[model samples]
Target: MATKTSLSSDDWIKAAFRALSSGGVQAIRAEAIARDLKVSKGSFYWHFKDVPDLKAQMLAHWSSQATDAIIAAIEANDGSGREQLRLLVEAATDDRNLAYGGVRTEGAIREWARYDSAAAAALKAVDQRRLAYVAELFERCGFCTAFSRSGANILYGALIGLEALASGELADLRADMLALLAALLQGGDSSQA
Candidate 1:
């Protein structure tokens, strides 16, 4: 039996992240987290009203860090739209770690969103923000409105695909991204060019 002890809300949140990352959202159990933290289940109740509350808190935490932060930084950068778009591609592709979550986290959150209404709504908000950021960058790079929007969709799809491929041996998709970036920057109409 696990010993009863004090556990902070942060501890539960961290455990929730690990659980979600490893086994998807269904793996998040207050009891499991309490055990992992070497505390009584009461520790969890002290921080969260119940499992549903814990799940909501965890999803919000993930969305804020994994989606909002990345989009905000890309939007805030003082560079040309093309430059920002290129940098965003590099940031999303490069092995160089930064103060953000990876594509896998995004994938897991997407899975969570499929079954949870609140998670789905959060996912929609994150997607809208990310698309807007990408569109802004593309527009700044001189692409037309339709081209920018289409480019955002294409780039996002490519990123998710590359992330899945990265789990195998297809090392880096940087070259492909650069090629796409070059074309977009040159005003290659994504629809017909």
Candidate 2:
């Protein structure tokens, strides 16, 4: 046995992320990552105990980044409750292209969850935080608790649907959905002043 060669976690992470995002969670193989980095499997093993270990670390990293965005945006808003919520919704909807616009891990994760409890758990946690954030935004904007919570779910669902559709005929779908959501939040119906 030889001492494992040195390699940065970031390099492995980048390769892993690209593989997952481009293909799916199933595509995240240690051998593939090693190939992507032009390194030996020892390098991946040196950083991660196994594929599951890599998945766990990746999920944790994604959760932190996503949660931080929500927290930071709220902190920076510093305005009326409605205004703050507005900014959050905007931020949540901003740049659909970068936020899994044309592609998504939804289907992949759903399948993986059958055999991968860790991935399932990670997805559930992320979704809870997302729904809670949206619900808070709706509540701050003076909506009733029940309606706000339900609406938050609806809003999130719509976002995901639009993201899926953005890959096909609904190319302009994101813009349309954003406009509709903004209007509703601003207290204007589909047809009103």
Candidate 3:
């Protein structure tokens, strides 16, 4: 239990996310998070009805923060479809571009989805929504139906790869992503991975 402190639902959620990232979904247990945060389990119950509730909220938070919020922001901004695509890629790789930003651990969440039905469903919805948005943008940019879909898939897959596998400094990865994005948009060779 946290000594001499008060914690909100958001605080518990943040701690849960950290736990999830470092120790996988199993680490999201309420008692574990409370211990990690040095807060009483009562504090957790105050915010969530139970572990399942927290998991549901956590998935909802992940989807909204990582997908819905980002898409809404990009759509609200004034820019061409291609420019929006660039921004989308930028936000995915670097949370600094977002207003409601925090440490991103979608890679861990994706791994969790492999074992948990709720997580899997949430991830599926996010994937479908995000891909649909990308396909729409590609269409707006004048890509043929097949090409636009292929472009969306390729772009989304590349972003996921970077999230899961890319190494090196943040700056280097960002630069490399930009180069890859350019090549992909131009439909040029990108076999140098």
Candidate 4:
């Protein structure tokens, strides 16, 4: 059990994410999270000004870890764009990406966005960033601008839909995504096709 003095802001954020994953945004109450963490509410206050502050910090942390960090990791390797695209799909679909306590944090956050404007905005920003990056990868793979954008939209939309599906229902989403990637790459300049 972590004592109040030993708890960090990251601990509070992670606890809040777990609460959000299990029970939605309303479950992210500081007191509830503190109880879950076996710490007092004062510990939460020590790291955040209030619940809203924690919520803001939580969104920022999620964005940094879930989006920015993944992109950075994918870029660190000197693979070709096609290889990077495959890596991106693998990384995105990897259970370790957003799974927390067997729940998809991305799904939870998307659900939270339905009621929270901040969450919705954050989601929109993340989506745009992802789409742009995917499109850039396609461009690097010799796709035209329009084709690259369209491919990014199709691939990203499918990914979001797959994430919403039950795990048992997805026979092999990663393979499906890779198949889609191969098809897109084969199309090779949609305007000419």
Candidate 5:
């Protein structure tokens, strides 16, 4: 039996995030989340105007927690481009997940984006922001503009791929990322074993 408890908006969001993690967009129903949190249906209405409102807020929360916060933390390190790049790699390859939600949640959001224009737009913005920061870090390391963008794409693509595949070999990916970073910083466009 689930006990009824008062849930704040953040609590609802967290429950929603968990739901999103497990079942994609379809799983984010008010009834489902309320049941999961053992809260009343009224509790959800208290937090959000409606389902669309909740979804929009979810996207905003995801964007901030997943991309903005990571970049800010890395920048705050006051490290060189290469160092920041390394940290970024570390952040991506960490054992948890992308940043907020794990691979499944990311995949869920992406899946949702395909059918919803708003989700698509939100995802596009997140991608652009993430790509831009990676490019900036690469440029700070003295890479040419084209190469920086390319490197950002390559790295970002690799992370997305890993998440898509739900691969669990972080240790190997970390090694590969470091090797790739070394090659990249050394004026080589390709990575070697």
Candidate 6:
């Protein structure tokens, strides 16, 4: 175990996520994480003002690692928007590509959002950003604004729903997500659908 003085803010945040994945939002206590980290609560306080502050930082870290980083990576590759969208689908469903722990962490965060205003707000912001980015990709694929927005909503919604339903291996889920992406890409314009 690392010494208290050696623990960084990211270490605390990651331990908190592990706790969240195993338990729930209620389990993300500084003392509990400190215990798990084999550090003093003073280590947690050294990095955060309090538990709420840690929670806020956790949310920020999650948003950056999950959404922002994925988008940046996808954009870094040279591909048509259609190709990029396909990559996005793969990344979203691939358990190995998960930013934090995996589906459990996402599920826990969503569950926390149900009753926590800050969590809910963070979720809303992340959703909006994801939807907008997806919509932009759709537009680049020749879809009109309305169709792009609609497709984004459907695709993103399906991803979230799949995450909620996910357990153990995600082979079937990846296939299902790829099939959905193909269907969305092949579907006609908004006027026809």
Which of the two candidates, 1 or 4, achieves a greater TM-score against the reference? 4
Which model scores highest in TM-score?
6
Instruction: Report the alpha-carbon TM-score of model 2 versus the true structure.
Output: 0.76
lDDT (10s digit) by residue, model 6, range 1-193: 6776788898889889888888888899988999988988888888999999999999999899889999998999899989999999987877653435677787888889999999999999999999999999998888888888998999998887777667555436678888988898888354333
| Higher-scoring candidate on lDDT, 3 or 5 | 5
User: TM-score, each model?
Assistant: 0.77, 0.76, 0.85, 0.89, 0.84, 0.89
Q: What is the lDDT of residue 13 in candidate 2?
A: 66
Lowest-sum lDDT 10-residue window in model 1: 95-104
Clashing pairs in 1: none
Q: What is the C-alpha lDDT of each candidate?
A: 0.73, 0.67, 0.76, 0.84, 0.79, 0.85
lDDT of 2 at 146: 76
Candidate 5 wrongly placed segments (more than 4 Å): 1-6, 95-101, 167-179, 186-193
Model 6's number of clashes is 0
Worst 10 residues of 5 by lDDT: 184-193
Q: How displaced is residue 170 in candidate 5, in Å?
A: 9.5
| Per-residue alpha-carbon lDDT of candidate 2 for residues 8-73, written as tens digits (9 for 90 to 100) | 765676567767767777789999878877777877878898987888887776566556666676
After TM-score superposition, what is the CA distance of residue 50 in candidate 4 from its true location, in Å? 1.2
Q: Point to the candidate with the largest lDDT.
A: 6
- C-alpha lDDT (0 to 100) for residue 102 of candidate 6: 70
Candidate 6 — what's its lDDT?
Answer: 0.85
* Preferred candidate (lDDT higher): 1 or 5: 5
Tens-digit per-residue lDDT, 1-193, candidate 3: 4542467676777788888777888888988988877877777888899999998998898788778999999999789888988888787778542222233367777888999998999999999999999988877677776777888888888777765555323434456677776776677223211
Candidate 4, residues 1-193, lDDT tens digits: the string is: 6777798788888888888878888998988999999987878888899999999999998888878999999999799999999999988878764424332577889999999999999999999999999999998888888888999999998887776673447547787788988988887655432
Q: Across residues 39-137, which tens digit of lDDT does each residue of candidate 5 receive?
A: 678778887999899999989988987788888889899889989999998876675453335556777788899999999999999999999999999
Candidate 1 lDDT tens digits, 1-193: 5333455565677777666766888778988877777787787887899989988887777667656766677768888877788888877676532222344555677788899899899888878888888887777767777888888998887777777676454746677777767765665544432
